[model samples]
Target: MLAKHSKNKKISDKAFITSGKAKLAISKYGKENVINATLGVLYNDLEEIYTFDIVDQEYRKLSSQDLYGYASSITGDENFKTSVKKIVLGENIESNFPNIYTDVISTPGGTGAIYNTFKNYIEYGDKVLLPNFMWSSYKLISGEAGGGYDCYSLFDSKNNFNLLSFEKKVLELSEIQKNLVIVINDPCQNPTGYTLTEDEWEKIMDILKRACKKTNIVLLNDIAYRDFDNKALEFKNIFKDIPENLLIIIAFSISKSFCSYGLRVGAQLALSSSHRVIEQFREASAYTCRGIWSNVSRAGMQMLSNIILNKNKYLELKIELDKSIKLLKRRSDIFINESKDIGLKILPYKSGFFITIPFKKGIDSKVSLELEKKNIFALVMEEGIRIAICSIPSHKFKGLASKIKEVLIEIE
Candidate 1:
């Protein structure tokens, strides 16, 4: 007799291996000296601003009973949860749009959130639509969910996600798949750092609405680096009027926003008009949560709650964050402008911590590895090198640009 659940047994490819550039940078530059333009981490000094006195004191005052109690059982302690909900949902709910629900469950990190959401919604043989160039986690999570579906390429010859091409793919997928989830990363996309313009978002949303009107589909908006853009709230506001027919889900993370990566706190907000549908979604998500990590880190939740509850402190923290974001933008502007001056080609990047540089001759990953010999670290994607700009110090921008130019010359 065949062993039960044998079909589900498979080798794990979900763990994201660190990029080669990251390892080289850490080894050569001693971690601190090397500019880490590889990960989506904010390097601004703002910890003091986010520090909370009241929360600390209150936390200390809590007895053993509080530690063991359910968060919802505390009748008067709803404000912490409410404040975080507001920040994550933004103007999407304030304008009478379908609001995002926060009580579904928690996860160790945003990746966990993605995995749980996929587990809850996807079934074997079901198809999930994704952009050709997306965060690698989407593929890993989707595979772990059930090993179903295929990715549709969204890139043009110029290596951009073209609207016309994307729409064509959606139309084709609609013909074959009844249950579909389309994932879109907006505002400082990981690995690419491409932020969609308001007009671009509008066009895509309109097309998705039209397509889903005739088919069963769900839209998952992964705003992992939403905080990197100064106008994150404004961009989120544009989604307020999305049609109710299209099932919408927003995955929000505090990792990049508050520089709380180690905390691993993230939330999934499901937007739907049907109470029954939302309820089922919540139940299924909770089940997945139990099966996986069995809920998020309690300490992480407390830290986030503390930061949100103290408004004055939060504003102070935002001010410091604003300063860091401005500095990051300055570094990005320097890199892009200097590269252009030297006749080097790069993608159009407005917001986000990364910039993509496409090689004219189409170099392979092995040749890209040679970049490490010059002390320039970068994540090599299929199209080009993705340089993380957030960690690059402002003073060193010019020197880094010059080195990259020299590398290009040598490679050519």
Candidate 2:
């Protein structure tokens, strides 16, 4: 039966089916017994141990009526709709996010939101542009949607987003394809943890604008970890004057931001020049959501709405989350700085949980396996290892770095 199902499906032959680093690390260390710094998971103050007194009571007081029911029913609830609108507009502008939207669809997770957004817009065989080094899911999801996806190489030794390479890809794609979608993740990028410089972002936006002027392009900005970095900036204002012909979709999630991984709550904001176009896209998106997960959890949506609605609660949560972010940053600094001090080459890490360390010539897999012997496991990406700095205690980072150094020396 499984063989028949596989034969019927049109799976992509070009797909890379290797297991991820997180799994390898877990396997080597044993799932229940690993000092895993391989996944970008927050590991502090996660419990609701401290009560907010009245706020706790208020949260408990909320009934089903108070929460937005379905995606289509969101606008009917005046208060819920208003809060969401405020979040999308610049009214309650936070550090990283600026533009807010009037209509937003709640989804099960960031991946769900991405799936729905792509399903709404992309047709079979349509091509989407993505950076080569992106979350592995982008290609998988695009292929599942029956869309042809292409990569704009970011193979620079500096590990930065190359504007010239991006432009060349965009121009080449425009010559061949009529419709394209470009995806970008900022702040703490996955795998490499590299962030774009302000100048690089400006050039990228310019390239996007120029490409959109010539051909139809959709900009899908996945701000999953937008709040991870203290130095992160808002670019919504910069995109305000973008061509009306272009469609911008923002995928937001609280999993990484609030450490609410199990909740699986996320929202998708679709921006377009035409209200009619937005409405049509939303209908398609809603259908896709219903087909996939039926509906998002009421409890998760209520928790997020409650926190955002109460200013004091929001501030308190922000402080707690900031503490965790700072801890992760400190750990990342120690690992990266120590590697540099010891004359070890590391991929440029600007603002993410991961730092990629390339192995000395011919020493990638051998070093990784040897570290496994020492109870140290990391995600090996291509010829490098992706260190999950956010997963380790700040005090443990130096010791871990030293272990990795020792392994590298042995392999060399």
Candidate 3:
């Protein structure tokens, strides 16, 4: 007999299936003739998948042992864990976190970080709060952990972070569960490209601090697309002081940042003022790692560690990443400007891979099907059509926004 969770388990995600259709079209009509934007990966103007030269070259140069061997520890190699702390919290640790203790555990990627978080933090049959708009995997991860998930509205009428909604959900869930966990996918949130302002983040922290009096609060900051953010390390200062009952776990990823998606390297960073809390976190996260991936990739960890430890390589990587950011900005600008001209609405966007076109609750699937007939392939969700601007060339963005608008109106 199959386990209860295993019986009805199916891969219900549409992203890959849609991408497969796009791929067949690309083969039949050529990539130049097809507008394929179903996946989250980045592609250059030449229609080639992008892989950072700095990361690629460094990885290729790794010693055979590093490339073939396991990471030295279940958590990670020491250097990687240290560099990860620096990357997640920034170099000014003493100034930012004068009194807090922090811990890092390497995972297979940001996905693994979240998996561990959901597995460890959420109790069975308990519900975890997620944003209304997010990467689909959050729900799957929660389900895998035997926890239910609910979504809070991501934006208000003014199209700002819906803190009112967030607070209501936080309080409502705290009343129901002894331990509360909320996942905030931000800083270039997938499918929306939205980043929370420092003020919004401050308000969120304040809300959590107040909620902590009633129950333990765990805020999982999924920062997978953080390097594409508008500011560098500006959000780190918000962690200066924290309530003892509030646990902030940041999910760090190298997939999008280093163009090392296949390498599967990332870490979870736990920040708390209580030293004992950190020790407990270390044990739990490391134990979860052994059960799941055992250890992360030594070569990928070394690649990032090498880049972070050396100022020259770090600067070099930054320059290249800045170029990609600029390219993404230009692409979004083209689409955003054209969208405005055509009267199409997108959710608030600052930086990152995608732009979401909000539609009526049930029409997103219809709109997406129509778009497919026009040779445009995008990921369709319950609420909107997701345009992967990162995978499309800058020039291709022209007029496509208007075309989407036309399609929307025609269907209506």
Top-scoring candidate (TM-score): 3
Tell me which of candidates 1 and 3 scores higher on TM-score. 3
Residue-level lDDT of model 1, residues 1-412, one tens digit each, is: 5576456555532112334555567687775555555555655432122323444454466556555554442111344346555666643354545453334345666777677677777667676777655676687678778745566654566756688877887778777776667888877876667777777778888888778767766778788888778876453555655554566777777677766677676777667655666787777877776666665655556656666667776676677667767877888888888987887777767687788776654664553556666665566666667786776567657767667667766775
TM-score of each: 0.82, 0.82, 0.98
Full-model lDDT, candidate 1: 0.65
- Looking at model 1, which ten-residue stretch has the lowest summed lDDT? 45-54
Q: Rank the candidates by lDDT, best first.
A: 3, 2, 1
lDDT of 3 at 70: 82
Candidate 2 vs candidate 3, TM-score winner: 3
Q: List the residue pairs that clash in candidate 3.
A: none
Q: Which lDDT tens digits does candidate 2 get at residues 304-389?
A: 66776778876776676677677767878888788878777877788767787766456766876786676665665546677777
lDDT of 3 by residue, 227-285 (tens): 98758446555876788878889999999999889999999989888888888889988
Which segments of candidate 1 are over 4 A away from where they belong? 1-35, 44-81, 91-95, 98-104, 148-161, 233-237, 240-245, 360-362, 405-412
The C-alpha lDDT values of all candidates are 0.65, 0.67, 0.88
Clashing pairs in 1: 37-388
Comparing 2 and 3 on lDDT, the stronger one: 3
Error of 1 at 159 (Å): 7.8
